[model samples]
Target: MALKFHIVNRIREQVKAQGDKTALRFQTAKGWGDISWRQFGQRIDDISRAMLVSGLAVQDKIAIFANNCPEWTITDMAALQIRCVPVPIYPTNTPDQTAYILKDAGARVLFVGDQTHADIAMSIAEQCPALEHIISFNENVDFAGHPMGMSWEAFMALGNDNVEQELQTRIADAAMDDLTTLIYTSGTTGEPKGVMLDYANFAAQLESHDKVLSISENEVSLAFLPLSHVFERCWTLFVLHNGATNCYLSNTNAVREALQEVQPTVMCAVPRFYEKIYSAVHEKVATANPVKKGMFHAAVTIGNKMATSIQQGKKPSALLQASYRMADKLVLSKLRQLLGGQIKMMPCGGAKLEPTIGRFFHAIGINVKLGYGMTETTATVSCWDSATFDADSIGLAMPGAQVKIGKNNEILVRGPMVMRGYFNKPKETAETFTEDGYLKTGDAGHIDAAGNLFITDRIKELMKTSGGKYIAPQVIEGKLGKDHFIEQIAVVADARHFVSALVVPCFETLEGWAKELNIKYHDRMDLIKHSDVVEMFEKRITELQKELAKFEQVKKFTLLPSEFSMTNGELTPTLKLRRKVILERYKKQIEAMYKKHM
Candidate 1:
């Protein structure tokens, strides 16, 4: 068991015992590297010792503005090991967003990942009074030219790097009750606020899942998920506590190749990854040989049948059993082989995955367990217990989590993993906390008889009509998103009246349709305005309307020329839609589309 002591102590203990075991790996531009626990721990020790010598005291906040790398976790462990708070800034965060978080958190030391991070931080260093020093995680990108700092290796040399006993003493100073990490959330309502979490939240979450999930010691996880995000952070703890080695993806673009080389036993990722894989397969099959396509289609059919039987708790029939074996051998098996066939399970989170996708993977013998949660919930609420998973539902609540629907159907969450209120915003914090102390998740959801939580909508996202009929736009929007052509959507229903949708078609999906129809376009803007593409969306909208209530149907719609972008302030860095911005930007266009005379 990891030291229920602060998160840092857990890493210390893991290193002490699992010295030779691989703790971290990185898919470099050159190739893959396997770093041992002892070396990983030594890097943490050197950083913490250097900081200590430099007068970084307990509770000091250190900010990391870097991409996914082995050094990110090394930095994380260094802070927690010393009972200090580490604030992780999103690697792709705008300079404006980066400034606000660093200044507000009063970060003392900053680890800038690359020139991109260094440039942004350097630009804003004048305004951030608390930032004392910057360390470069990259060697080639020297910081000697900068006014604030130096290279990472030089920073480490400032400490007594060989002080093993001093390292132990520093970790001993750590406490589970001490502040460990501060996650600043980019909330929908207002400015982002820091979420102060102690060792308890991380320990409670990692330990709870350990007992429930029992990942074996030698299991490997290919982690490309943003370490700044709680989903990956908690999963990293899961890997660390289980004695599993965590490999970092070189970049998002390197994910496919990394998967082939590493062939990790388990993967924790968002729904989009699976969606891309599914889409790529669909695209490939479109041009594959007739025999191969037929075989692939037949394999999917068998997998679907097997998935249904498993979900229903029945064994496959003799005919299906034989067919599945054949499919596995001929078609589906090669797909698994590409992933190294060690893919025992996939935990898909960050958004609701289509149940059909889950069923399809399960049918083909991959366990894609559907889980649900938010940043406020410390990122894990429910996960499909592989032992008793129901593909359609968002699994059962993780151990020790309480889910109760409140007065207006808001999902009230109470658990050890629940975050301390948003940093420095009591009024907002008070509003999110119930009188009885449950965290008001702002999500509309209900618990089933079997203890599964099915989220339906957001309380703040409902659209009401003149007659007082109200509808949750997210429900309809999510369903509409399932249509391959609909890439981005904003179901606008703010104070005005009835519902309408602002749709952005997946350019690839729409372009495929446009090609099939012998239509040509120069770009997304050109394609969106094309009568052929607009007509395609119109048909899709009409089809989905059949699934909606009369009052809830989207009466008028507009196909947007360009999708929402982070730079333009249309999406959260996590890539969630900012409805208010979308509503404001497209109001004029939407009004034109909605004119009764038009």
Candidate 2:
């Protein structure tokens, strides 16, 4: 199929075709508000002019340190319009981490979301000599009367008719190889690396998605994932390219409420989102009466049968079809309503999703497209097909992408969407690619005969016991994490005598169970340490790991009162576990688990 979209001039095209249509939607103090395509295009032009007036040259780096909001995308699209590279800093980044990226990228202008981000940028402004301006999206941000700081409105007012011609020229000069963005990878170890993505990279993503997914101007996409992440960033552009209304969600804690209000037809999310929903549903079912529990299971079974038949290209029997319709009306539809019933498709990635959870969503009417990609590959390289859904596989390689297994079973990819290189790191960039030109994904996986990709584990994360049994910790964690009581788990077995784990329980569920049993505790720490609580977790862990190999099962565990968080540096911005940090942080607890065995 011919490419229907390209990121370079997508906004202008959308504006000309549908000027009055809603291009953006955001939550306001009163309620929801909309921005038309005409307004969206005008804002981009104004920002582009402002950059030119500020003396920003082509490809000068502009940093955006913000949560998801309309201003974030406006700034990003604006920077692109003038051929400038927009570098995104995760909103949760620390002052030190923020300084590293600004200094490394040599950003000329910084855009911040709230007072917190503004203060962090201001604190590090002197450290980054290249930074000349800081614009705050939140007008209420306290700039302390800093000369270099200004509100977004004031910055936009700097644009004039004199710079209008220059802005137009820059937009017209857009090229395929122009550097589009510099996304810093949230590395689990060492400093983060800047991944350079170009117009060609995102163009390839638009084209590939056009072939695999069906999106139109009428579709409503909820932008909940951090736009700083590659998946959501690219998907947001695609949504605009299709002239769809893109809803901006600033606070992640309000996602449930936003979903109900927006009723988005499409959205991009991580596997954790789906896992949490799956766990919540199962948790409620676990406490229900026998009849309700039986009905829920029976409904899921019927839905699964119908889903399986369709996946295998067979029509369901008439009786089966009738049964599925009944199940959908009574049970499955209610499950979907939790996500806002209008969902047509949800693209899930960023971590391994348990196959059972993937199957569960598929059994319902909701279509979860579990794809695979990275900051190195402008978002998606593979995703589920509507005609042949395979919950266990990552579907086929995208239309213009090539995937193969290299030495160590690492998944290697070469495609238009693959990144150019790590910005300013020639040696590291050279090390990332094979001589034949495939980007080494550093993930171990295999391709089935039918061209489906199945990821086993991150090669670097694989753990081996002292007895030499290799264990994929993610597989074990994915299984146990499905239990509603377990919130987070990190398997510890590398060069150790036996497998062990540090688990953080779902406190709400655990506390409710404790109350039901009439157990008393002083606090979360006391609750977790209580004999009854410990015994219950022990029993649940044993049952959850029954399918795992004997050597891979978690033999000993330490329960933590708190969930791993970005603030504590235990997790990366994308929420991937920083195992080294986790290991060091809980050294005492980890050592306790192996002290007797040692």
Question: Which candidate tops lDDT?
Answer: 2
Q: Give the TM-score of candidate 1.
A: 0.93
Q: List clashing residue pairs in candidate 2.
A: none
Looking at candidate 2, the ten consecutive residues that score lowest on lDDT are 1-10
Count backbone overlaps in model 1.
0
lDDT against the true structure, per candidate, is 0.79, 0.92
TM-score of each: 0.93, 0.99
Q: Per-residue CA lDDT of candidate 2, range 53-97, in tens?
A: 999999999999999999999999999989999999999999999
Q: Pick the candidate with the highest TM-score.
A: 2
lDDT tens per residue, model 1, 167-284: 6776766666677788988765577889877777777787778766768779999887888888887888788877789998747787777888889989898876766666566667
Identify the runs in model 1 with alpha carbons over 4 angstroms from their true place. Answer: 1-6, 142-144, 161-166, 283-297, 335-341, 496-498
